[model samples]
Target: MSELLKTLLVDQLNVEVYQNRKVLGQVAAKSVALKMKEILKDKDRVRMIFAAAPSQNEFLEALTKEEGIDWSKVTAFHMDEYIGLQASAPQRFSHYLKERLFDIVNPGEVYLIDCENTIGDECRRYANLLTQEPIDIVCFGIGENGHIAFNDPPVADFQDPAIIKSVELDLVCQQQQVNDGCFTDIESVPTHALTLTIPTLISASYLFCMVPGTTKRDAVQKTLCGPISTKCPATILRRHENCTLYTDIDSCGAVEER
Candidate 1:
């Protein structure tokens, strides 16, 4: 077993775990489709958290192709957006999500972060919106720093009081965004962003984390093996009752699961 898996085992942790390198992208895509269908089966009004990143392209494509979802009944809330970015900007998470998923499904409602507005007020407004209804599922990705939902390494608080906040981007996290093609280079990437706090995500009924590529291997290992600390923000998922991590072969590396 890999050190990451060993650590998880030694800690006597509890979480529904599934790791795959074989047919990684396909498995993740299929799993997401099934989960969406499962959630929509009984609930007429469903709310979800949408994540935008290159790693999620395949998964989102698979979701868009899946039939039978009552798109009109679903509502979506964006997980994060770049601070100072206009909704029209190509780098905006809102634009990315709309082109990839929302435009295809035409959900009942789509709440995007207004990054251009006063950052603090926007966070509070978004928080109030999240409180209006329970989220059925949240789609997310792991940052190269093992962060989740833009909640960078040093700022991620499992018990954060604010539902959303403006955060300064760490070097690793910013570079990862650039490397993923969200920007031409590190200098072009935004220095700050608005992100959903760890507590807000933990409140969700379910969370699906999709992380692929070898570049993320170390992060995956750290998040899976490291202590449940803000340093490894994504580790908080271990406390979630219905959280899932989906990764491709290169990303899984030495982690063992049969």
Candidate 2:
């Protein structure tokens, strides 16, 4: 909340640039926590979908430090997961989320993709849970390939009918795993993943997209400037009514230079 470097609008998406990821995270956490409280004022529970990646660390940590939000009344779900990692693998998206966020605040219910299950069964199961009730909030990040969740350009569908489906990782998306230090190399990253489709993620009432670091500069620029197309899948956010994009000076640098 310190003097924001800049704030602008791209269609329906609101972009706010902060001094660094730390401030970006703190501000996003506060805004999300406040929205959660507002939703809980009338509903007994809030269903939130969260993304798993190092980019989410600061915000997740700051959100745990937030006060007045009844974490026990929140139902948590992650947006995607790799198919091959062992259940105990630290690199697994589910494991990453549990260690950082879920185990800390302990949402009342937590739903995650099961890598052990057949891709078909798991997708159907998670899709059911997702549609059981309307999603209140989605906290996510855009990939270096401009992906949302694991909805990489090659497999992304702007109007996907299936709520969840299996997707082959695009080369760029696979390399991003190594770049983020989630995987030691491209081959170690799973070729396929189960992700909530674009329609599913965009269905949420509110969306908070945290994108930071210098590596994300081009993706951020495409997300804000390109035509709304699957070529830059995250560009779909521009059509969302209540989505906010939080960026640090590093990630916002390209747009600033424009």
Candidate 3:
């Protein structure tokens, strides 16, 4: 394993910096694999949530190839999905996960948020499923605007009561989809999405946040140095007891070691 450039603990959250995305992903995946092995020691099945984006490419790729994980004993869930995108759409978050992780691992079960269903009905259904078991882990990333999942600054609620909800995507959030090359243009991105709320994401027993790229520099700065507020939704990560933020030199731009 490559040595980390720096390891900072902001309250209960751990931030690990590496020379680049590939190394960061490898280390993060190893950590996740070890955690899964530990959890499986006493549990028959583990539930996990995943983020689907180009930013997660390396991490997910490394994770699927990690040994010791009985993929059939894991239940998979995705963090968010565009409201109108078809299941076959390459831009659909579910399709992204299927291609990158699910197909390779073939988990025991995969519960995807139904974007084609009635918004309210789908939220209720997915939320109910989430409550059926505690989430063992969540692999996610911070957006350029500091959003987590689809919980953009304008829509994030730290004390949200619902486990899942439909939210209108903020302009910055929509533009990020384009910046990540998930969509050709801003107009092509979905205006709204079904997302696991802030409270739901934090409910996981462990969180592995893989954020790598210069584009996330500003958001990373605010997430670590700014106030713990919804203004920079990713800031809430610092409050989680078992959350770790994995970053590369490009993303750790101005956030000095603590």
Candidate 4:
């Protein structure tokens, strides 16, 4: 029942793969906890990056509950946020991270892109902060549109000059947020967003991407099989030396034939 199309490379990045979504999420969470423990051995401080999305709800929940992770030595960062939204806004990435991971764990430093600040200045400041630290691991999600962060299809560049910058949300990207129930409707979602570009996202020592659900099959295919281009932002993972993609049977359907 498989083999209709050529296998995509990104689909094969997993150091380990699982047949069950729940088990996949659990193994990924444990793998990250273990990886961080190993990386922190040689470094005094470790930085971690996280992304916010419905696809990550289970993964983040599992990761936050992971036993034995040294949260005290870790500094945290997130991938993106809506440009005009307040940090206190229900839709803000900062709030999502704080509730889902940071507040639950006492990290050494937790940096969030201040969406209320001037976009350009805030972008540069965040970029400088990111440059000062060597990221140990990055946990992220692929948008149903294949965006890595807010790096929507058109503006997601592999060589973005700034670590964080504003991007106009493509319809598919915006719709995915709503489809995932992050927003009540498309009209309620902010059209502009501040996002960590591809270069910075791919800069981490290890990257763990959590993707699940049949809604993501097309995107999973594009990201894994399509050419490594900005057209499908997440495709850049194909070049990373250490990247793990966690997905269930449904999301894995596109590449199952491989």
Which lDDT value does model 4 have at 109?
89
lDDT, candidate 1, 104-179, per-residue tens:
8899999989987898789888999999978888887788898888999888888899989999999999999888
- Selected candidate, larger TM-score, 1 vs 2: 2
lDDT of each: 0.78, 0.93, 0.93, 0.81
| Clash-forming residue pairs, model 4 | 8-225
Query: Candidate 4: misplaced stretches above 4 Å?
Result: 1-12
User: What TM-score, over all chains together, does every model reach?
Assistant: 0.89, 0.98, 0.98, 0.92
User: Model 2 — which ten-residue stretch has the worst lDDT?
Assistant: 249-258
Residue-wise C-alpha lDDT for candidate 2, range 43-149, written one tens digit per residue: 99999999999899999999999999899999999999988888988888899889999999989999989979998889889999999999999999999999999
Could you tell me the lDDT of residue 190 within candidate 2?
A: 91
lDDT of 3: 0.93
Ranking by TM-score: 3, 2, 4, 1
Model 3, residue 152: C-alpha shift (Å): 0.3
Task: Give the clashing residue pairs of candidate 2, or none.
Answer: none
Ten contiguous residues minimizing lDDT sum, candidate 1: 1-10
- Which digits, one per residue and each the tens of the lDDT, describe model 4 over residues 1-258? 121222234444653345656776777788898998888788887888998887777778898898887888998889898987765788888888888888888788888888777887898889888989778799988888888998888897888877788889999988888898889999889999888888888889999998888898898888767888888888888789899777777787737433
